[model samples]
Target: MTSELIAALRARLGDERVSTAESVREQHSHGEGHHAPSMPAAVVFAQSTDDVAQTLALCNAHRVPLAAFGAGTSLEGHVNPPEGGISLDLSRMTELLSVNPQDMDCRVQAGITRQALNQILRDTGLFFPVDPGGEATIGGMCATRASGTAAVRYGTIRENVLGLTAVLADGRVMRTGGRVRKSATGYDLTHLLIGSEGTLGVITEIQLRLHPIPETIAAAVVQFETLSDAVATAIDILQFGVPIGRLELLDEVQMDASIRYSGLTGLRALPTLFLEFVGGPEAVREQIAVVEAIVSDRGGLGFDWHTDPDQRAALWRARHHAYWACLAYRPGYSAMTTDAIVPISVLAELVAGVKEDIAESGLTAPIVGHVGDGNFHTIILVPPTPEGLAQAWALDRKIVRRALALGGSCSGEHGIGLGKREFMADEHDPVALEVMRGFKKTMDPNGILNPGKML
Candidate 1:
């Protein structure tokens, strides 16, 4: 059946666009996660929306399972083809469809990456704010409902995406939402597809909201003798309505890893907060002043400041590389990373509990997060043994339970995908899961769209 389907794909998309080659299949098998690879029978690269529609039509007709692949930087198994069929590679569909500077919105093909879009908008004094570290495709970011450091101010992909062009499981192209900021329209299917992770359909184009690049941007790094002081300072700033552009926390382990990984000439590896403020010069200065006083009250050390673009960029560079830094912190060890978010009130407690769990489990895990929004992540280093893997999962569950107990969620930004699917029931109501399954069945009746994901 796969052979017949492959032949059909080649006939439609040309032989060069369809591949059953071993190397290509292997490349399309998995993402950046530690999940074991499940190679698809074929990889089909789509160059246009029409190409996607036609290929999806073929797959649906053949009842051949298909998984969408974008920038392929997903940390979970969002791109893995567990039930091998066609790995629909959309990386070639990199076209900027439209940009409306007046309306502060733009449309682009699913394959255009975050960096590419921002680069295109660089001269316009406007930028897309969703920065989920990595050269992640805008479509992939939309699919995952990704959020990052600046999310506290500008919002996540969910909030910024104004519309989507999605090809359903049956190859029907549907456009949802529009350029308007608010609409009292139908079922809001745009949001339904966002964070759906391609389970219901393949997103081919996205209409995204854009924000003006700030007139003045300032970054500061503050170290604390205790994690409590660093966290408290962050919490106070958020609670005080600072509208901070970015607030990131790095525990001692993560700070140490980042110091070595990103190079630091005059900084200590203590519990640290990397902060940013963006607005008019006066507004940024005021925000920084308020945060500075808060930090000083909490006994935070040297408020190393930098308004220079190069210095600010370097600071974020280190924060973004925390994952790789943690991996390097324990050479020859696999890292299992988890993201759990709690209410601001309970974030400190949750972090303390997570620290305790890491110690009790005897694992080396570095913690980093955009804690201004109460989401934190830990990269747990594990041995290359079955016992190590089991221990990592056990710790993950403990962290999830802690968050849930605090009236938070199992996953803050990372979607369920293949990693957090088991925790769906634990996080959501049974009725919610049933409704999600209904939506899935209604959309992809043949179950060929990203099977065995989410609900």
Candidate 2:
């Protein structure tokens, strides 16, 4: 059955598009996350929506699962083909279809990464702001509903993706939403597929909303005596409507790792708050003043602000390289990153409790987060030994459980691939899960679309 499916895929997509080589299969196996790798039987480097539809059609006919592989940056095993069928690589379908600068929107194929799209739009004075750190494909970002530093101000991929073209499980092509900003339409299918991971369908093209470049932008780095102080100041700034473009938290451990990894810094490696305020020059200055007062009151130390673009970029550069930095902190160790988000009110408590828990476990898990939105990540590093792996997994579960208990989600941006599926029952009601199952069954009766994921 698999051989026939591969033959059909190659015939339709051309021999160059289909590969059964061990190296290619290994590359499509897993992403940056800690999930065990599962190599697909074959990989199809789809070059167009037609190619995707044809492959899906063949896979559906043969009852072979199809998993969409983008930049392979998903940390939740979303790109891995656990059931082992065909991995649809979408990197080649990167065509900028249309750009409507007046509408502040553009249409592009899903294979384009966020950084690449922004580069193409640089001349237009508009930018796509959903920066999930990694150079993730727009399609995968939509699949996981990804958000990053700028999400606090510009919103997430869910808000930026106005419309998209998707190929259903049975090879039917459908479009959801449009260039218009608002619509009181029935069932929000656009949003339905936003965070569906890959269990729903394959997103082919995307119409994205863009934001005008800020007139003036400035970044600041402030150190706090304690984690509570840093989080307190961040929460207070948000309450006062400072209009911060981004606000990130890095515990001492993460700060140290980032400093060592990125090099060139006068930072004190204490619990730090990385902030960016965006607006006109005067407004930004005013915002910084107010934030400074709040930080001072909250016992924040070394409040350093920089308006130089290079300096601001350098700060965020270090922040974006957090995963690698954390990994480098403990060489030769695998990391099980956790993405637990809580209400701003309870964020401090969550971090504090998790810190204590980590200390008790005697683990080296550096912490970093987009604290403006109460979302944080812990890179739990473990030796390759079985005992070490078990301990790391235990700590990950403890963090997720704590977040759930505090009225937060087990995952904020990373979708429920294989890593967080166990927490779905605790997070969602049985009725809600059943409804989700109904949708899955309705859309993919044969279970041939990214099986062994989400529901």
Candidate 3:
């Protein structure tokens, strides 16, 4: 049966596009997560939306599972093909279909990487702002509803995506939403598919909203003696309307790891807040003043501000590399990073508790987050030993439970994928899970579209 399906796909897309080779199947089997790799039966490189539709049609007929593959940067097991069916690699479909600079939006094929899209928009004075650290495909970002430091100001992929063209499980092509900024449409299928993790449908094309390049941008690094102090200062700055483009918090352990990994000197190994302001020169200066005042009031020390593009990029690059730095602390051990968001009012307590939890667990994990949006991440290095894995899993669950207790989610940007599926029933009520299952069944009756993902 598998051979017949592969033969049919080869006939439709040519042998060059379809591959049952061991190497290709193994390459598409896993993502960056901690899950053990499992090879898919075959891999299909789709060149167009029509190709995706046809592939889905064939898979639907054969009852073969179909999994969408992007850059494979998923922190959870989002790209894993658990059922060992056909993995659809979308890299070949990369294309910037059209750019409407006047309307501040662009149409792009699902496989276009954020870096590539931003490069194409360099001369247009507009760029996409959703950066998930790694160069992830726009389709995967939309699928996971990804966000990053810029999310506080620009929102996540969910808000930036204006519309999407998707292929349903039944191989029907459907368009959701429109180019307009606002809509009161019936079902909001665009949002439904945004964070579906490719379980409901396969996104083929995306219309994304872009932001104009700011005239002046500045970044500031402020160090504090305590995590509570840093969190309190960040909350105060937000409350004072600082117009911060990006506000992130990194504990002393994370700062130390970053300094060692990047070989930087003169950085204090203390809890810190990394902030960026984007606007006119005057506005940026005003925002900086507000932030400085708040930090000073909260016992922050040595406020260093960088306005030069190169210097600012260097600082953010170090910040973005925090995860890698954390991993370097424990060589030969894989890192398990988890993100959670809490209310701004309780952020200080939450961060403080997390720091204590890590200390109690006797684990050397670094903490960082987009504090402006009340979201944070804990990067813990997990040894390959069975005991180490068990301890890491327990810590992950504990953090999720704590976040939920404090009116936050188990995951802020990372989707459920395979990692957090067990927490779905705990995060959402039974009724809510039922509603999600209803949507899943409605869109994928055969359960062949990334089965075992999310719900």
Winning candidate number (lDDT): 2
TM-scores of the models, in the order given: 0.98, 0.99, 0.98
| lDDT of candidate 3 at residue 171, scale 0 to 100 | 87
lDDT of 2 by residue, 72-94 (tens): 99988888898899999999988
Return the candidate ranking by lDDT, descending. 2, 1, 3
The clash number for model 2 is 0
Weakest lDDT window of 10 consecutive positions for candidate 1: 261-270
Q: Give the TM-score of candidate 2.
A: 0.99
Q: Tell me, what's the RMSD of every candidate?
A: 1.0, 0.9, 1.1
Question: What digit string (tens of lDDT, one per residue) describes model 1 on residues 34-72?
Answer: 788999999999998889999999999999999999978
